[model samples]
Target: MSVAIVGVAECDLGQTGKSVLELQTQAVTRALADAGIPLSEVDGLATNGISRFSATQLADYLGIRPAWSDSTFAGGAVFEMYVARAAQAIEAGQCGTVVISYASNQRTARSRKMTGVFEEGTPEADFEEPYRPLYPISYYAMVAQRYLHTYGLGRADLAEVAVAARAKAQLNPAAWTYGKGPLTVDEVLEAPMISSPLGKLDCCLVTDGGGAIVLTSQSRGVEVLGYGESLTHTGMATAPDLLRTGAVDSGRRAFARAGLTPDEIDVVQLYDSFTISVPLGMEALGFAGAGEGLYADKPHNTGGGGLACCHPGQLGVLLLVEAVRQLRGSGGERQVPNARTALVHGTGGIFSSHATVILGVS
Candidate 1:
């Protein structure tokens, strides 16, 4: 059976004052409108694991309770997994219309709090967070360091990905990182250092926003040609391999399911919480050699990714939105002509979990 994304919507990114539920509601309404559907018709609802909002609250606000509701949290990649699950739900006749939503107030509400750490049972009380590691920035920085050490790559190579993403963001009106013409390698290199090898420009901004997409299996939406998932950590990062992730395994599976290779992908939406991730994803997705994925010619993260967009927990949703828009030839200034196939990579948990989805125009 084939699945398609019929509608996509997102609230004003980077805008504050909107509650998580309100943002989610707006995105839902927009997505339904985009899908040419109605709230009463929505029977399925899937949300990210890390989202603070509740599905019941969303349903109450929308005045339509879904028969199938999933509130699983697997970090940012959960949205990609949600899409894949929506396909099965559509095929099983469990629901003809599914809405996947996520929202967060990272910038204003987060307030430098250690929220992610507290969410997990804090060993802080007993062990003083002995097993606890650094925030995403520091953790991913370690990976970047290891990557640089293992591959002999310098900061300049990583800066290229940031420059490309920022350029793409300039075309994306919804992107928070949107700005003037492309950034130079020197500019990125000179940016303030946030976490050692990872500079300020290399880090994604903190953002608060919500985004949603509607899916149907009737081939009336963007085709869901393939989906694959993999995991590198079990809740915490006790593993030794920090630089490399499960993206390779999942990406290969996704491509095989679509019966296509990396070369066939017209655009790539690589999860770029850190500049290092772009190059890492390139290798995992088979775009270039291991530790050598950062190059000027590749069409990776053309829309600035999380680094540019900074949609808090809604990063994965934005990636899906961009991919769908590109595949439908509706990306306007950022549009890639003849973009028939697209790959969106969603990652979460310090790159511990990953999901890859291949979309095609049918």
Candidate 2:
């Protein structure tokens, strides 16, 4: 049996002010429609959050009677993990169709602050919290600073990442930043500084949205060739090296499992929580050498990614949706020409957790 992503959809992006459940249900409905299936056919469900009963809660709200369910919380990489779990469930006869969904109202319901949320007794609280990094931008800024210093790169290198994403967004009508016009590297460099070496343009947009995917054992759609995940550290303070994220190990495992290589990927959808993350991920994923990972000339993040598309907390699900679109030749104006293979990567926490999924036409 082979697992295939049969359906993929994303809810409206940016400032919807909808409840998390509303966003999730809308995405689920859209996904089911795309798959030409009904809720009754879905026997497995997966999501992520701090809530202990989220799986049951979602299953009940969606009126699903899932025989298998998972609520695995791994920050942004949760949805990729869900895809892996859904495949296992389908292969083992535990389920036939599995739906993986994600939703967050972070922009509308909460402050953008990324501090003091971790458990009080955890390493984040003991070491990272004391530093008062304030928001994710600040933490990522520290990493950006280190990366630039170590590699002899400058802020201009990072600016290109933002510029490329914005350029891609211009072609994506659904992107949150669509119609904002393309951004130039100089403009990105001049954008207000959020933190040292990182300006507002380098950061991702905060939005409220949801996305879902339906997977089946029969290979009737884009096949999930391989998947991999890794966790290096939970806190920025505890990370072995800020410049080296877990994407290296995860990407290696995914490519090996898929029997592919960096050069074989036709499109790349690396998580871009910050402009700096793009280069970091590229290097880790073997797309480029150290200090040379800025993909100004490569085909990547064609839907603009989190930077210009939408970032509603966990973005792995959206990345998967975009990859599916590209693989199916339905990416519209932003579609990569004859895209046959895609590498979708997601990062969680500061640089802690990582997940990679390789998808190809069936």
Clashing pairs in 1: 5-222, 49-72, 49-73
Against the true structure, candidate 2 reaches a TM-score of 0.96
Best by TM-score: 2
lDDT of 1 at 58: 76
Model 1 C-alpha lDDT per residue in residues 41-130, reported as the tens digit of each score: 999998753335567777777788787877767777878889888888888888888999887776767653433533546443244246
Per-residue accuracy of model 2 over 1-362 as CA lDDT, tens digit each: 78999999998778888888888898999999999998999999998642567789889998889999998777788788788888888999999999999888788886454333466688567877777775567889999999999988899888888888888999998889999888998998888987898998999888888799999977689899999999998777788988888999999999998999999899989889999899998899988888888843457899999999999877899999999999999989888999999999988888788999999995
lDDT of predicted model 2: 0.87
With candidate 1 superimposed using the best TM-score fit, by how many Å does residue 276's alpha carbon deviate from the native?
0.5
> Global CA lDDT of candidate 1, please?
0.80
Query: How far in Å is the alpha carbon of 235 misplaced in model 1?
Result: 6.9
Q: In order, what lDDT does every prediction score?
A: 0.80, 0.87
